[model samples]
Target: MGCSPTRHRSQLSKLDSPSKLDAPCITQERSIETPGVSPNRKLLLAYYANETTMNGKLKGLFEAIFAKEELEVTTIDLSYHNLNVREIYHLQFVLQNFQNLRELKLNNTEITSKDIKRLYSSLELMPMMQVLELQGNAICNEGIKYLTKLFFRTMKSLKVLNLSNNRFGDEGIATLCKGLLSLRCLEELRLNSNNIYSRGLILLSQTLCQIKTLKRLGLAGNPIDFESVRVLVRSIRSNVNLKELDLSRNGLSKQVKYMLPEGQAVIKA
Candidate 1:
């Protein structure tokens, strides 16, 4: 990664100077999707950018910029933050500028399934979004309902998705897959380390048959067994867009090479 220009870095430093929230966030402009989008839009890299229980300084900065007519924020990443659930939830509402947002990352935020509704409502405001990553949260099946709502709304524009490290079990995974059946635009999916097992694998395998647009699928560090992977292997066999598959740390590792069909060498166990 290259360094930001001196002038911009100087200005951005003042806005997000917490001395401890050393998180780095990147914001790329979607020129084709959102023409005339501001290149100078302020990005909120809320990765615990300070040593406070709550994001007091970050909240203050957000309020200052929100006072303007057109909000300038395009990215809000709260990964590895110390903010409580309420503070994290409140940040969603204060993000008055959503029309220009193209990426949303909230990894390791300690968010639960109950906060999905508020997050979904916030989703409606960002139409140009192309990437949505919510890894390492506490979201369960109940929270997936709100995620499906957002998916139904943004399925047309979303191209990249990551929901790994959540508590979405078989039922939850199946529900999510049901909603993603028509997400033809999606190209990458990450579901590693989410406690998925045979049932979840079966449901995902069924759904994978219908999703032919995904190029990368990550299911590493799960509880998948030989029987669980049989259907998934078959489903992926017919997929033309799939280029990489990560199945390491799962139960299928020992027999993975023998289980997969001939000439299919992209999978990693």
Candidate 2:
């Protein structure tokens, strides 16, 4: 079957902020394009990145592609746009239009709990979504609460989840734990450098042990101590499906060696 005609729409908008230091920066006014729409729109890639300098021409390209109806939009590098949520909360309109979206990346932005809730609310409408990356953002425990809730209640097709580098410590982890109890299909999870302690890591390990389909897990740069690593060892020693486990740059000591015959663990300096 051919792609939907509404998938072809073109829309663009730009906003700029003053910069203190110069390092590959693109002014908002010179970045995004104006709004336009076409029925033959088929593909959408929304890379709203930060730290990546984008010119107005690139913005115009993204907007035009994003506006197409029924188009599949994949968002990455959302840092270019502001994350205040109030200013461009209307962007959700653009977000909700992509019924065929697959991948979404929102790393290093200032997304808060409210923004997460809004995103979750819209996620229900997108049934085909599979991968979601939200690393390096400030979505704390509250935001994780919404995420876990969505994982349990709404987004069932979700496969890969990258939540590394957020400050979702014990509280956030606990909230996520409750919601992920039923996510049986989640395969890969990245939680590096999130300040998760022994308690939270243990709880997470326990949760993962119950999951049958999960394969890979990344826990590097967390605050997990030897005690937590022991808990992890105990939890996954018997796991049958686990293929990859990244615990690099954490509390693991040189004296501590790999206990699992199949899995790998890295030590920090």
Candidate 3:
């Protein structure tokens, strides 16, 4: 069965000088105002409603919100929105403004390597970003090269990263691991269903032992082999920080589960 797409709610919080106002939660209604709140404070609340079409609706919404002033947004979720070239350009503008953003979700947005290159400078400004989800995009090996720079330079505090189904094979995996070692606060990493094989797993296994903060790893739906699995098991065997390893639907035998460390949990087929 195909997995359902995850919908992420955007969380926007604004902090102004002196007195602090409570941030209103953004839902389907996209309400950004509350009673008894000052007009200035209400103006600070920016809501990005989910848009089915990216033609003029998305652009108009962004212009309406940003026209007042630059919003101090913390989270932005634009998942499941098929963005064209013009829409992606507007997104880059938004990212450029939100320097203090903490979370950004662009799952299944149909972004490519060229788009990633364009957004590189904007992404560099977000030093405090914690979560970045780009699952089901077309960010192949070329995009991974740009991400490697971000991982080494800016995204030191990134905690969760989901890159599943991006088609960044063993070459991309090797390039990604080069920068993954620089992350000091990464906890969860999802790269499942990415057309990876034993070679990619071997490279990733070598890198996994170094990331002491990594807790969960998702490699399911890949065509990994027995020898690489053994290599992976040995590499992370002494890694006490790693808690869960997902290798499900990889055509591995049930006996492969016994190869894991005593305290580690493996989800094998």
Candidate 4:
């Protein structure tokens, strides 16, 4: 469904950062007929960037979508859009509307630790949210760790998480593993281009062996060498839940690709 803007004479109040008692919120009403829901019933928010003219417009659009209190999924990319403090602050208000939100994405944005914390604090209101993507932000190990703690503790229903290209190195990946260990429902995890190596990959593979629900794992565009792949394969050989793995754009040898576990698929080269 296409969006037709109706200019309502709504007040644009200046919002403060969330208080101790306040929660993340939105005031719009959205329906399943929304443009992006799929057969799997996943709410898609990829078109959020192109629909609004500016941040203010985007906020208004979100407000309208959330007021109905029915929106279950949302995806947004805040990259190269001049997202300042006020814009992030407005997002705190926008999220409150998605009490039932299940999927969320904030790819390619210049989010920091503080912004991530803000989002996390709000999502804490919704306990059933599943998939989340935070690719292309500057949230490194510290930020990732912060999210891991919160996600593991609250979002037991979470299934997928994409945290690629966020400057998180091996240490950050390790921190994420700690969270993954506890994610009973998590399925897919994308950790592309965060400066991870064999050690981190091995650690992840080792931990994933214990996670029965995990399915696909993406480790593309990182610095995992042939040796690292060998370690990863060896670590996950005992794991039977993983189905697909992406290791594209890395300089891996063909022999290592064949080393994937039986019934498991690996995408290399």
lDDT scores of the candidates, listed in order: 0.67, 0.62, 0.74, 0.66
Judge candidate 1 at residue 260 and give its lDDT: 50
Please give each candidate's TM-score. 0.75, 0.71, 0.77, 0.73
Estimate, for each residue in 115-211, the C-alpha lDDT of model 1 and write its tens digit: 6656666677776777888898777787877777767776457778888988576777888887787576888889998878899999899888888
* Cα RMSD for predicted model 4: 11.5
The TM-score of candidate 2 is 0.71
Q: Pick the candidate with the highest lDDT.
A: 3
Pick by TM-score: which candidate is best? 3
Model 2 residue 206 CA deviation (Å) reads 1.3
Ten-residue stretch with the least lDDT total in model 4: 1-10
- Candidate 4: clashing residue pairs, number: 16
What's model 4's lDDT at 157? 83
- Write the residue-wise lDDT of candidate 3 on 46-91 in tens digits: 3234333333434443544544443346777777766656567667
lDDT of 2 by residue, 46-134 (tens): 33433144334334334544444333445433543445443234345445555556666666655666678777766666656578888
Per-residue lDDT tens digits of candidate 4, residues 1-269? Answer: 11111222233444322232132322222455556434322221333433333354345445445443345445433434445555675566556555676766667556776677777777777677777878876786667767887767777788988898876788887888888876789888898888888788888877877877767888888888787677676666665777877887787756566777556765555
Tell me the spans in candidate 3 whose CA falls farther than 4 Å from its real position: 1-64, 67-71, 266-268
Ranking 3 against 4 by TM-score, winner = 3
RMSD of each: 9.3, 10.9, 9.2, 11.5
Candidate 2 residues lying further than 4 Å off, grouped into runs, are: 1-62, 65-70, 74-82, 86-88, 263-269
